[model samples]
Target: MVLLRTLRGPAYTRILGIGDYRPARIISNEELCRHIDSTDEWIQDRSGIQQRRQATPDESVVDMGTQAARAAMTYADLTGSDIDAVICATITHPYQTPAAAPMIAERLGTKNAAAFDLSAACAGYCYGVAVADDMVRSGRAEHVLVVGVEKLSDYRDLGDRGTAFIFGDGAGAAVIGPSATPGISATTWGSDGSGSAMISQSVSWTEAQERYAPASLDMPGDPARPDATVTDSLWPFIDMQGPSVFRWAATAVAPLCERALAAAGVTAQDIQVFIPHQANTRIVDTLVKKLRLPDHVVIADDITDMANTSAASIPLATAALLRSGRAHPGDLALQIGFGAGLTWAAQVVQLP
Candidate 1:
């Protein structure tokens, strides 16, 4: 066993860089309508999504995540060897035993860096940001990489109207390092477990496996029979109560934003960008109106192109805003993420 040493001091943490990786395959609304009972106009009117990116089989969650991380490191003018820790936020990691963080660290060549994964659904990115800030402030780390990635194409049910059109695959990352001045404010987070079922998998993986387990090696029915069939449950896919989620997002999440702003000692008018999770365009509009933000505040609408990327949504939206010239470094931005766990988190931070 090895001994560990701890350090203590007051430090400030700020995001040094941001990066994102969107899959190459773009699926238009017309293409989606082919598989589900949805139309371009209907999808636009409801979700404001015209197209979404779907990852190919070659693009695994870790692959996209590592790419985003490398880009972020480059933008920060640092190398993998410079990182002290890594935090990977995702719910779509294919393996159940080993987390995705260590693999990401290994690929980044951060052999001595502490690595781990966090699962908070759509709220994961913001939570990771909060944790990174705290870790730096407490002198536990000097530089940290926070990555949010998802491969929802593997979990989406193409025939389900409720979710078939709402998910996409992508990854986004940010580099957090010590700063001489404050760059990130306090975070506000909460969850309503009673509503956890509003967004979740239709069935658990173990349950699905058991449901399809063979009754016996000897076939119960004739193998050649035309009518022979096996009773099995629907494939485990992401599902959501659309109305419930919309209601909760539009109404309940506004207070969390208010709390975040208050904690940061800022007002709605002080914000330069509002980066909420790309869950729905309508929800973004609702929050903007409910918060009474000024017309000058740029709101992220990445959902139109990337759909809801769950834990990756906030970082993805942030990167898009910065890349589009709509927001700039040192700008004040408010970010909020909510989903699956009936969880939500928010924070106000200055851009890199």
Candidate 2:
């Protein structure tokens, strides 16, 4: 029997830097209300979103992700050659075969680094952070680029009142590398697949291709199909059971956060910031009350301005806090993300 040598890495890992990209196009509640039957006040009372960003038609998921990744790398004082791996978390990449990570890696000029995509819906960014932290500490990668991006405009249904005004397009990224002291703590994450249907696309890709391909293939000016009209059903749009999701998030997620804090061996008073998923203000408020967090802990409310950028929410919120001087380097932050898949991930970290 031959003995194999084992690889070991650093004692700790920290997020070296963070970045995000918000598209230039801003869609206010008044504008969104023009398409849906909702009023701006109603939308605000429901989801606390006054506006959101939507990428242009030419902006692909890779494009937004690459820009965000570049920003993160720049903040970390790193270049493509320094990245050993890239992980992109997204559900709206539009392609199923070729993942978005490698494309982002190519755009960044990475030197053949390991790359892949992750599909954890809104919980994705936090999931990527956990994975990157492990990879760095295990010596699998020296520096890992984790990007959470979503071009949700492609899947938005203006006619759907429940979700039409709830989503936005954006990208956020982080660079994780070795640290002298612990910066990332144990992550408390889990999923309840039983509630998977609470938030999802109206149809799978297979269903869309099989059901709508024949009609979609016809030319618009074809003489035989001069009156052809494509309905919203021809493409998959976001479908969500709002009440159920809100209930689960408001009630169940607080305990998960408690576990994360406990796992980190810290109390709520030790945290300087609380960055929860920018899903809804009501949910955030409920979690705050349940956790009994003090007033000094700055809670992120980026949802009011950014809407739900799915996986990009936490990091984008983090970046906002940093820019506004609400959060500082080495400050302890407790972050949690939960959505779709009824998934949830929470962790405590020292902000970069």
User: Candidate 2: where is the Cα deviation over 4 Å?
Assistant: 206-234
In model 2, the clashing pairs are: none
- Scored by CA lDDT, what does every candidate get? 0.86, 0.89
Q: What is the lDDT of residue 305 in candidate 1?
A: 93
lDDT of 2 by residue, 1-352 (tens): 9999877999899999999999998888987776668899999998899999988768899999999999999989999999999999999998887999999999999999999999999999999999999999889999999999998877776667888899898999999999999999999999999999999888887786676556655524212113322323335778999999999898899999999999999999999999999999999999999999999999999998899999999999998999899999889999999999988898998998
Give the TM-score comparing model 2 with the true structure, all chains together.
0.93
lDDT of 1 at 124: 95
Task: Estimate the TM-score of every prediction.
Answer: 0.91, 0.93
